[model samples]
Target chain A: SAVISQKPSRDICQRGTSLTIQCQVDSQVTMMFWYRQQPGQSLTLIATANQGSEATYESGFVIDKFPISRPNLTFSTLTVSNMSPEDSSIYLCSGSGRTEAFFGQGTRLTVV
Target chain B: AQSVAQPEDQVNVAEGNPLTVKCTYSVSGNPYLFWYVQYPNRGLQFLLKYITGDNLVKGSYGFEAEFNKSQTSFHLKKPSALVSDSALYFCAVRYPGSARQLTFGSGTQLTVLP
Candidate 1:
């Protein structure tokens, strides 16, 4: 099991600004993933943070909007660029293990 | 492509009663499934996973989930509900052959009323 620690547990940001949420895993993992959970909604997959190359994004989500970086197996970051009120949500990061994946506490971003 | 659905948004169960949270999956091949629980003001914690073999899988805090292939369902169950068991439950699925990431369900909020 890996413990992922995410920075800036909760932050209120102004519109048009960007916030970068960092996650650090206690051990190495094969893949790192990012997700978004809006108010009263389920989680949506943002992207898969690859260690060396560019991240793999899901449909409706683009790299420019949610840029992800995985410098190593145990570290990754997701930046919410050009924030808006709609972008206000909880951003969570997870590390895929052998069987079950572990998630971080999540960074709650509120854009006003 | 691959997805899981938790039909119910909210489930209320009285304490000491059995509880079930329904989840269904749609995929091409075999389903790699997982269950997670998010307590109030906390991150998601892995409850259990069903990769193969066992249909009834036990997990943390006396929680268990039954995997049904015929119905394409994996419902989380607890014999005796506790007030602390009240939380948001999420079901996740990974494609057996191709996909690298897990598709998550919308999530179900469980309330174990005292």
Candidate 2:
């Protein structure tokens, strides 16, 4: 298990605006996962961030809408571009080892 | 592909009584199952996980889960329920070749009446 944290515990933004959430892990990990949990819904993986390479987005998600960046093994950032009301959700970042995965505190984004 | 399913939307238990939250999963290969609890406005906390060895695995917050390979189910249990244990619970699973990316269930809201 690793200590993980996310910046801006929560934020409220207007539609058409974008926000970037940062994820920090205390220790290095091989792979990091990004997920979106809509209000009162299940968690859906947005992408898998790889160190020194582009992220692999899941079906129904795109890099243009949810761009991801992993500069290193311990940190990554996700940007929700052109936000909409439907984009209001908890953005969670997770790090994975060979066996288990650990999550960050999460960023609660509310789009108005 | 690996996936998890939490059949119940919510479960209610009386204080000091045993509680169970049911979960089932599907995977192409062997499964790695996990349980997590989330309090209101808080991040998810790991409850327990079943990797390879034991059918019953214990984890933080006095929570434990049993893995039933035949039925492909993993149910979260607590011997005695507490009011503080009321929260949203999630079941997650990952299979080989997924690189440890877990697929989480919708979640089960558990309420312990005092």
Candidate 3:
């Protein structure tokens, strides 16, 4: 299994501001995904980040609101734009390989 | 659309007793089933997966799941429960041969009491 990590385990931000969450993997991987877990809810896929290309957003998410950057196979970032209280949730990153799926610690964002 | 359903919102079991967490899925094609566990403030950890071959798949932390294709269910099981097993359990599924994405169940909180 791969070891994945995310920076700024948590943060509190004011509404209208933006916050970028970073995810790093121990090794290069082919599949990297982002997900959002709202309060008392199941996780929802945000996008699939492809190295050197644009991320593929899921049905309810758009690039404008959740811009993603993946410069390489082991690193990616998700920026939440124009934050609102509703944006408060835990953001998780996952990487998939032939054997197992590994996830990062996750970033807990609180928008006030 | 592909989706998973964890019938029980929570499962309570006494330590040293057997346990089972039920899961059912719906998908257009054959599904790749997986079970994951999450501790408080921690990332989801891979428990086990049923890609092919065996009907029973063993995973990390002494966990196993039985895949019943006829019933479209993959329920997690353990011979003996532990207090440490208390956590959120999630069942996920992906369509066969597709890296498209995984559909997750609502999740079940498993609490093992001493």
Q: Pick the candidate with the highest TM-score.
A: 2
| Interface Cα root-mean-square deviation for all models | 1.1, 0.9, 1.5
Instruction: Tell me the number of clashing residue pairs for each predicted model.
Output: 0, 0, 0
> B37, model 3: CA deviation in Å?
0.5
Per-residue lDDT of A77 in model 2 = 96
Q: Write the per-residue lDDT of candidate 2 for residues A1-112, one digit (tens) a residue.
A: 7788898899999999999999998775678889999999988999999888889989999999998999987889999999999999999998877777888889999999
lDDT of 3 at A91: 96
Query: TM-score of the A chain in candidate 3?
Result: 0.96
Candidates in order, TM-scores: namely: 0.96, 0.97, 0.96
Q: Model 2 segments beyond 4 Å from truth?
A: none
lDDT against true structure, model 1: 0.90
Tens-place lDDT per residue, model 2, B1-114, is 677899999999999999999999988678889998989988877788898988999998788999999999999999999999999999999886666788999999999999
Arranged by lDDT with the best first, the candidates are: 3, 2, 1
Superposed Cα deviation of residue B83, candidate 3 (Å) = 0.7
Alpha carbon lDDT of each predicted model = 0.90, 0.90, 0.91
Residues B8-32 of candidate 3 have per-residue lDDT tens digits of 9999999999999999998867788
Considering just chain B, what TM-score does every model have? 0.96, 0.97, 0.96
- Candidate 1 chain A, run of 10 with poorest lDDT: A24-33
Candidate 3 CAPRI grade: medium
Consecutive 10-residue window with the lowest summed lDDT within model 2 chain A: A24-33
